[model samples]
Target: MIASTPRVTATHPSLPAVFLLGICALLNLYSPQPILPALAHWGGVTVGSAGLTISATTLGVALTAPLAGSLSDRLGRKRLIVWAITLMVACTLCCVLSTSFHQLLLWRFLQGLTIPFVFAVTLAYISEESSAGSRALVNSVYVAGTAFGGFLGRFVAGTTLEVVANWRYTFVALAVVELVVLCGTLFLLKKEANFTPSRSLLAGISGAWRHLGDMRLLLSFGVGFLLLFQQVGSFTYASIALLHAPYNLPPPAVGAVFLVFLLPVITTPLAGRINAARGPLFTYLLFSTAGAAGLAITLFGNVWCVLVGMALSCISIFAGQSASTGFISSHCQHDRSSAIGLYLSGYYLGGAAGAIVPARLYAHFGWPGCVVLLVALAAVSCVFACIAWRK
Candidate 1:
């Protein structure tokens, strides 16, 4: 048998690092999903309050990711990663230990602080270390893996909660997964300790400011926000709408919706190729417009509409997300981590912002309002795509 050598592009540390990032992502998002019904019952909360678990994490990510990313850029990606993981461990433990709604909210908010390091610095590291030819390929792997990890996290949360009577076990299981990933990360990731740590918080803050002021970065930020806004706003409320009235899907059926939503992410590598060749604008529109159309089907109030919406939004979210990260990496000349921080900060921020809006819309106009909001945002996103395409 002839022996073949491994391709260099196939060998970057990002492959493993992304797996680690996936664990962190799983730790970050998995809890609220399966536990939402329990949380509502436990806390006597409205649908909106039940949803704040998602919003709190997004808010935490939005507000603190820049700081975490800037710190990593200053200190070293590995060091910051270790710190973020440590804090994440503490937060995850707290999640398992918490006794009250307020307590879970507080811990989840703190947990959000860790996402930027995994999201931004990981991207920065991949951008820094990967060869030009394989940068996008590595990105696709990392992003797609992270997406899969999210599914795994949801699986852990859903199954553990179902199998074990205690919700604490769900959080405990997430913490255990994180611990394993941490150990793997320590071994598999290339140590960037030789890199100079950014010492000044003020400098990081200033660098973020400077990056934000750049029109390119701002445009990138807008793209990031719109991508997530349309995604979260539509999906969150659509699930609620489906659970109401005639469709009346079981909770498990609702959960299965997310399962199917993840299906298109298998094409993340292709989306990366599309981004690299046609540019982010074309790819963003292609995905976002499809998502918008799918969301529009909600006007008809049919299960098929929900399914179509899920398909479009998932494809748009996955494709737009990877493309936005690539665009931010290419456009910013300054602290790459800092720029990525800002990008993801906006990304999560959109989740936070959209969470509040759709609830109010649904209150007034029912399903129609949610559709109007998504369609409007899609239209605006189209404008951004057009501008970016011209560049």
Candidate 2:
């Protein structure tokens, strides 16, 4: 059985830094999403091919997440996060220099390689540092920050591309925001007070391997995979669909549609309280069902209906993410960073497939087909939650 760790006093003041950590890590991940159509036009490729940009990055994240977790287990948390942020900023700047689609994918993949260092490490840090009572709240805040960052990145990229008519400038804008976030991280993020590094890198790897057999961890990893698969698939294709349809929204307006994310910014933090009150299994099942319903509403073909559906879907995703991460934080006793790394590897591997599979579905059967596939995935995720987390 896993032993529970004693909670430290929650550091309320550090919440802002934690929030910023979420933003900095995610600001670049999906920034290219809104401009996929524009990229296809510029690169003389199909939308599916252009989406390889997102796939490349997610693929990189999946491959590196476990290694990053192990490194954090051997290195210290804040040190790894700071170094990763610096490297991520450099990679974003390099994206601005890409003259070809393949070159852009290469830089994007490199950027993904650095993100798990910040994402997985901070999650482990929060799990270690916060008291059990406040852990859910802290995780919720971080998830909210990520939701906002995802919105901001898409908004800024789409609007900038619309205004400048140049996609490269969007990368420049993203790089600038990342620089500001880097400075805040350096100034505000606290050093780990509860970390106990592994005796060696090999030991850390061994711990990660053992996590694969833990049912709780494995189930959480499955939940994570389905969550991102639904999220990335829905939004990436929806953005492309809006570009050519009865809606005929411009890139800026589509970017504005991402304002749906702001709703989560306000609502996701409540997930902590909800998980605490209702339990993570209850929270996950409730939201997963709601997400499927929301996707069904999108088939109505009205723009307002689509926006409303998307909003519900987005909110469900953030809440489910909080619940899943909270489960890992509470259930896993040893090498929490490695556990989170494995979770992220599955999560982002789903993200990579989400980017590719939905585009192909859209190509052959259209938006309704994408919706059907995503809703089915949500249903499967709900079933897994029921089986894995049942009392």
Candidate 3:
């Protein structure tokens, strides 16, 4: 009988700890989403301007992800992950004290810069620690935590916004929740048994750039960018659309829409199982179709259709991401961590663009216009996925 790898056995504690890390990272990053309309009201900004809260944070993430990935290689993934959560907890608390939108944006951008410490490392950690047999499932578990975090952050903020009278207090409450998650992570985060810190920053950057030359990996990065752009842009603009005009959803009601995220908690693991059975290429194509179909359905104005569409899209995002991550991890060798980091840079850059550009589209073109933009991006992602498949 063959023995299980030391890496897999050692990764046991890392699994749930990184799960908590995913939750914490997402909670800090997405807290502004449900409250954009409130920001517009309290900060005397337009909806498009208010959406910058999310854009600024994601832009920071885009800027820092590659650096964080390299540092994770040099500093150890666990160290960076722990430090990021500690600093992010403090930054999130400080966000509540901001007196103006500009101040708030500054804090959010700083908050974003810290996110790569956790996110960039967590993927590398999972890739390094888990056995190939278990990597997809573990990745899916982390993705599930992220899905729940995005939901909880929006839901809690929206629900709290209903009762708190002050928007800042909603963040205060989220900060406290994250603080608990932080302490839990500190207790549970395991040491990296496999990683070797890079010798220097120059070598690390050069190594990461080398992976960018691979066409298959490059297309994967493009797919990551477009998928996230569609996800973030559609959701960010949808918040504003649902809050105004025909729906006029109250803050809590707007938050309730994120309940769609719950579907991924189920679909993500299922996706891993399917990917195991069918191969990631098939899994990617299947879910990409599902996501595009979901976006298309949203073109309908009915609340039921929109809700169902959002649910389908949520399932697609998590499952598709799991497949993509698994595929990337499987494909890379010496440059695995750097490659993931580059993918994340594209992913969050798309997110930053998604947050801002979709809001502008919605402002000019309305909700249908927003759906059109998402559909077009999803189609582009499909094209990229096709190219990746051919290679």
Candidate 4:
């Protein structure tokens, strides 16, 4: 008789650890965004080129996600996560030492490479450790942490730049924050008691391949891609737009704009409840449409209107993200880490594209052009959610 993989009754996991996982994973991902315009000036490059700092990190995330998944499946979850965060601290400090723009980009990419180890592995950990009754709630909390972390990163980076008149100090501050999180992770994160490792590396690879063949998973992946594309693309260029035009905001004020991200910290947990009652498909479509409307409001040429729109956009995307990730965790029957990894690969690939494509559009056709493209992407996400998540 063939032996089956061991299963343990799910336990109530540490919600705080999961939250910290999200924060540490994302703390550095978009730190450069609020100061992209200043970076361009400092580097003697165009806005689009400076945007590469964001893109390079996301590209590394996209490329490394699947491998991180496979390794987590073979080795274990917390082991990879702890090691990855340690490496991330080193990379953040390396960014401080960078003498040129290219070197900064290289370190950013390396930093990106370590992130999936924390966030992706943590997702699999949640799926395995949490009971069905509380799974979505825990996941929502993690998303909320990410939203806050994203805001904190940009706020600190931009504020430090303004106060010190030096951008490099921002990296030092990020490294310190990362170190604190790393220590918290060591204390709070428990070893996986419910995990059943894949039999071998070959088995993990074959499992990932099988996941790609599922139409439901594919559609979900597509939705993830479009969602980040809209969020990252809009915010990236919006900072630049605010720097120009009638608004003429300084870098510190632009960072303050990310306070809108705090909206998601409140809305995402609420979204988890709505998703549980109404279903992920309904939740995804509802929020995606709202996001597109929010994008439209940005074109009104008023600073207050733009912030309102961006705030709505931020809330909608996190709600949508909560729904999508919850659906994947609930639906995937096996190889949960591999599935989440594939989903993240598409998700951050969208983020990478968002950082680059919107900048080019903004240069050639202005903010309105970027808005139109993002709105269309939102519409596309709604379509995929309808098809994939239909009950």
Candidate 5:
């Protein structure tokens, strides 16, 4: 029989550790967004090229998450997380020194490479330890942490870039934050005693792959992809898209649209409750459709329409997440870290795809076309939902 992974029954002390981890993550993740415009100006690149910063990070996560996740399984979450943070700190500092777009990209990619391990370890920490009743709540807190990280990332970037003059300082601030967070983590987290390093990295990879061979697991992954695809696709570009129109808003004002993302703060917990009560499959069907519909409205190209679309999208995400996470927590009684990793791999991959493709649509076809693209993705998500839930 395959060895059963050790579970985290509960951790009274890990709470602050979770918070510190999220804050440090926010530092690395958001630096590019605020500095993108400056980077573009310095390098003479377009807005879409600036968006590549986000995409590069996602790409790095996609390429490295599996390896990182696997190594984490063998090496232990504390080691992987510490190593990942150290790398992120280094990459973030490098961002401040980058002279050109390519240099920034290189640093961002390295930064991206470390992110998945951080997220994978965090999710593993939550899943391993939290009680079944509180698991969803813990997951929501973790997601909230990511959202807060995103919020702060954008917040720091949007508020300071113009005043700071040197966009490099944006990353410098980020690096400092992560460095402080890093220092605290050393004392806060207790390393897992049960960590059994995999015989080889390949062992963790092969093990996860074999487990994911199930169709249900595959469907769960699809749900994660769609959830993040639409969310990231829409919001990552939200600031830029709004600034173009009648609103012609400033960068900071545009960043306020991230408030839509904050809606998840409320929805995530509610979704978890629904997930606990209703089961994962049913919740996904209900909420995923809501998100699709919201995106449909945003395509209409009016300010009010876009705002409404944004809210619906947030609601849809929570619903879909509820179901998707329910299925993950319930089904993968063992090797749940791998399950979370697979889900995240698909999720971040979709995030990466959204970062690149939707912007291209906006650049060429305009706002209406962007909506069309989002709608089509939503439609595809709907089909996946139907198939996955059918079981």
Candidate 6:
């Protein structure tokens, strides 16, 4: 007879640790964004080239997510998380020392490579530990922590870059912040009592690969990709746009725009409640429509309208993301880590694409063009959400 994997109920302490891990992972993943303009000036590169900093890290995560997820299944989530953070700290220091754009890209890529282990495992770990009744709530809380981290990473890095006038110093400061988060992650994280190691590494990898055939999972992946593409792409170009005409905001002001991310801090858990009451399909379609509306509103070009649109976008994006992730977790009873990894592989791949594509659209076609592109992506994301609902 086959043996069942052990399951341990999560306690109160586990919640904070998971939240810290969410913060640490997302902070590391997005630290370079608000500073992309500074990177361009520092390296004498174009805006598109500077955008590569965002792409490089996400591409790294996209490439390694499947492998990282499988390994976490084979070893343990906590073990992989420790290694990921250790490598992240090392890579951030390397980024601090980089003398040229190419070197910075290289280090960013390396950092991307390591960071996914933490991201891919954390949601899966939550899935394993929590009961179904509370899963959406806890997952929403974790997502909220990620939203906060995203806001803090951009706010802190952008403000510091404004003062320091050196991108290197900004990264140095971020690395210090990461180090502090690292200590907390190590100390606060508990052992994995719910997960059982795979019989072999190959078995783990095979299991992850097999899930690619799942249509619902595929739709979820598409939703993730489109949502992030809209989220990251809009933010990337919007910052540059704000720095130029119409708004003419300085770098510091542009960074402050990320404070709109505070909207997600509320929206994520609210989304969980909505999802629990109405179901993932209802939650997905509702927030996706909101996201589409938010993007469409940004075409108005008024500063207040833009801020309102951005805030709406933040709320809708996090709500949609939480709903989709919860759907995937509830569906994938086995190899859930691998499924989430694939979902994030799509998510960050969209981010990687967003890092570059929107810049070109902005350069060639202007803000209206970027808006059109994002709105289309959001529309498509809604279609996928509907498909998931039907399937």
| TM per prediction | 0.89, 0.91, 0.89, 0.90, 0.85, 0.90
- RMSD to true structure for each model, in Å: 4.5, 3.0, 3.2, 3.1, 3.5, 2.7
lDDT by residue (tens digit), candidate 1, 296-334: 765776888778767777777777777778777766656
Cα lDDT tens digits for candidate 2, 77-107: 9999989989998999998888898898899
Task: Between candidates 2 and 3, name the one with more favorable lDDT.
Answer: 2
lDDT score for residue 322 of model 4: 88
Index of the highest-lDDT prediction? 2
Collision pairs in model 4: none
**CA lDDT scores, all candidates in order:** 0.74, 0.86, 0.79, 0.85, 0.71, 0.81
* Higher-ranked by lDDT: 1 or 4: 4
lDDT of 1 at 88: 84
Candidate closer to the true structure by lDDT (higher is better), 2 or 4: 2
Instruction: State residue 240's C-alpha deviation in candidate 3, in Å.
Output: 4.7
- For candidate 5, lDDT tens digit of each residue in 90-119? 888888788788888899889988887787
Better of 3 and 4 by TM-score: 4
lDDT score of model 5? 0.71
Q: Once superposed on the true structure, which residue ranges of model 3 sit more than 4 Å away at CA?
A: 1-5, 9-11, 37-47, 237-252, 356-373, 389-391
Error of 4 at 368 (Å): 3.4
Superior by lDDT: candidate 2 or candidate 6: 2
User: Model 1, 217: alpha-carbon shift in Å?
Assistant: 0.9
Q: On a 0 to 100 scale, what is the lDDT of residue 121 in model 3?
A: 81
Worst 10 residues of 4 by lDDT: 1-10
**Candidate 6: residue 274 lDDT (0-100):** 85
